[model samples]
Target: MTTALTQQLVDLPVIEVLYSDLDNTLLGPEGSLLTGPDGRPSARAAVALVDAAVGGLTVVPVSGRAMPQLRNDARLLGLSDAIGEVGAVILRDGRTQYEWGECPGGIARNPHDTLTATGAVDAVLDAFPGELRPYEPWHRGREGGHLFHGVADVDAANDALAAAGCGWACLRDNGRTGGWEGRSVRAYHLLPRGVGKAPAVADDLAARGLRPEQAAAIGDSVEDLTMAPQVGAFFMVANGHDAPGTIRTPGGMGEGFADAVLALLAHRAGATRDNRQAPAPAEGTVVPSTVLVVEDDEMVADVIRISLTAEGYDVAHVTNTAAALSTIQASPPDLVLLDIMLPEVEGWEVLTQVRSQPHTAHIPVVIMTARTMPADEVRGYNLGASAFMRKPFTPDELLAQVDGVLQDTPRA
Candidate 1:
């Protein structure tokens, strides 16, 4: 009930994956994925998803909902994996990667059924009268955990369930739900002892060969906050109030999710300014071409990727000049977007090397930079730069330059 913000963070790991809680975290009002918190239809959430995908980051939605609900949500969200049933079931690439349960007596039984059979669900329900009730309609067809929604002293009820010969199952406060008693109430889950979002996330990270520093999680519940320890960064939506030791976002629901995603992407893009959507690509056949982006700044590289990838260009990025030259020699892309200020070597020298090489000489180079000296332009042209672009160019300019250069190049 108290809003206590987490202390701010100074340094963060380059996040490779994002674990998000659904239902009021990623999805906005009334479970509408595209709606903003202000109750108007908006595509900010959808665009954020595309930004993460184009930026080459994995997005996994974690929820207490069952497999069926998660399946539908994944289909609509253009995702292939989801963690459902509060971590009891995990589906990746359309197959069950990890499914947790307490199968007793050599029979496969779900936690919800076991809890019901052991009268644990009833014990918790009886302990809290009008304050707790079965979350019906949506609660049916669940295979991992049963849902309950209401306000109750969860600790006292969990103690009562343990004393009633149903210690195997306990109540988990799943954060806020719709109204009960004319005010907001929290959703609860009755799952087996070990099935929880945090453990499953930790185990999933290990299976992916990822360190705790490589992943981040965002959600709007205390249960979701448990993931803070397992991830490189953990963020809470403003609507979730506050918990200590977590980063708080400015927005709530889908808006919060979008903001957090962009922040993470910016960090990965070497801390470029947060990106916004580029102009939609023209409706026409797109020529598939691979464009190598040579920029140390992560955010700008990400924006370029979004713009080009939208037009069906395969984007490859390298943070330094060495990787750029190496990739060009190994497998020359159709075009190279080079930045003048690099870590070790300058972009003009790279262009000179490309021109001198017999095999890579044909590849087009576009010098993109913030420097606007007349001498720099002369140097770029002398080094055989095909096109020189200034920094802070619009998406239209980027698309036109690439399209024009690619069209001029001969293809066998």
Candidate 2:
């Protein structure tokens, strides 16, 4: 079923920036880069990302990986900015401009006196013994902050650090699926008290003159949750740790998840331009009409929401027939934008249910779908759909149809 967070994402009108976590969030289930049939990164995600960048969404990789690892991966993926070592190091334009202890461009203040508290690291190591091992990338890059792996018991690890009076915060990687036995191998990054992904992301956004609402963050673990408040939307992969109100993709890693987000961003960019030229509602008739959109595809649903909302309509969307019926029963909208193809129950059944109800019978329903046969139109119209609109429609066409439907429907 399409989640509420997914619907919310679809309704977003603009996404100026994208902040993402690496590892399981962007890679496949095997903890490697997701490849297509061609043995390279999935084309759908790659192309969509490229398209998003071309359309003006700045993509930044926010990861626990160290500088060298992040740099190599970013180069391979064509990404330019990255927050590495769980925000200890900030790389912009392929250069390290800020480290944990030092502030650059006066964007961030050093919250901690030292980048790495050796006593804290030693304490955790001494406590966990063989269970905790040094994350090698920090040593290779010679950067501050220490990352550790093989932390199956996050509580114990944190307790160990606390017992040692270490001045560090433990960020857990709940998204990592690899581990001995049936349990997953958990990883933790020991960051100084004031340095974290959220602050680092905020600093970067501020540098670009962007607000938190202008960006979206995607990740798979609790560590990534630190970035939730810093972006317009937060998405968690299906297999990752849960955060309240986070949109989850059906596909794990970067598969269907990244593609869906990129598609929405591209659509938003196009709709923004089209909306500028769109005609406004008639003067003095300012209160917008309420629209209920019933569609299954998150990407298409968002596109429709963006388009109709731009034309000054209050839009509500649902992904299946059950939700459509429930929404109609709870609060019947002025107009219903229905899609013929739906999950569980088809759109045809939803239309029948709406018409069968007393309160919603008079509400105008516009059937919008990719089904472009004459019989399909006849079928929809026969089932009480007020208008039939095929897919691949422009924003102008959608607004025009909605206006026509609302105008033809008489007020009760």
Candidate 3:
């Protein structure tokens, strides 16, 4: 059943700036950008986000993701600012600020290092035993908190930290996932005692010189609800647990987040007469972003297609520059993943033509090549390549490249 809009929410003042969570709120399951809550191709969230951007709303992603990761995401989503690492890292005004909320461990250097030196992470892990482990692969890059994947008794973990003489530390419940241990588990970040989403948000509000009435936040977890007091109000996606001052929006996942966005748009100055102007696709709608992969290798093309498809992007593959150009002329893609080594004509030729053309000059192009020569990168960049990605890149690296280029282009 749909939850009718509350008069209380409708009566609130216009929301000029919106702070939204990333993983399971602005995005769908497992951070799939194009997928809807029903696990189908949908641009509901992306459309709403773009509308908010075009309609003059300052949208900032607030999440527990790493700073660099969030920056890439912010760019891909056509946003400029974000609150990452559960508010531990704040990216504002072209700089990253680490807001280490008063830790007993002196702030002589990196806060994450100071927290690590206290051994609180180890203590939490040891206390939970097999139930806890560092969230693998990406966890090593975190500077905000020691991200862990487990079924953690948060209070018990805090007790362990305090017992270990690290009374200035605590555990934050990020969210739930089934990516490990063959069972659903929660994501936890061991952070400083006083540092959390709320305090971080309050600090950002002060920096922006905006009153609480001008701001609103939306998120899917209990950690997200903490931002309520810092903003004029907080809207929880239908998937999130309820809290005292939270209002649950309709739909689920990305669509639900978009609904909340639509609600705010109703009160904005440049908002449309009907805030639901960009609704979800009915049955066979196109994905929001389309990426064309131009690679000669079938294995490479397949890998690229699969990776992009999994991320909820529409992908078209062409093994040669001839087919690639044909596809481009037939239907212009949002971005091009071009390969340097192509049949008959080199990929550089395609890049040059694409850059010089009037109709397609604005489309961002990413050059992929195994050529390690310095001149190759220089030539690619000179030819207007948005990004020159070295060959043999992991899927993560490829996505990062795509994201970085799109961040600079209006097509994003």
Among the numbered candidates, top TM-score falls to 1
Off by over 4 Å in 1: 1-13, 97-107, 128-131, 175-186, 243-245, 271-412
Better of 1 and 2 by lDDT: 1
Q: All predictions: root-mean-square deviation over Cα?
A: 13.3, 9.6, 15.2
Cα error of candidate 3 at position 344, Å: 48
Q: lDDT of all the models against the reference?
A: 0.78, 0.69, 0.76
The order by descending lDDT is 1, 3, 2
Error of 1 at 66 (Å): 2.6
Model 2 CA RMSD to the hidden true structure, in angstroms: 9.6
For model 3, what is the alpha-carbon lDDT of residue 103?
69
lDDT of 1 by residue, 217-240 (tens): 999987888888999889898888
Model 2 regions lying over 4 Å from their true place: 1-13, 36-42, 99-118, 128-131, 136-139, 150-186, 278-412
Residue 402 error, candidate 2, Å: 21
Which 10-residue window of candidate 2 scores lowest in summed lDDT?
103-112
TM-score of every candidate relative to the true structure: 0.62, 0.57, 0.60
Which candidate do you rate higher for TM-score, 2 or 3?
Answer: 3
Model number with the top lDDT: 1
In candidate 2 the C-alpha lDDT for residue 72 amounts to: 83
TM-score of 3: 0.60
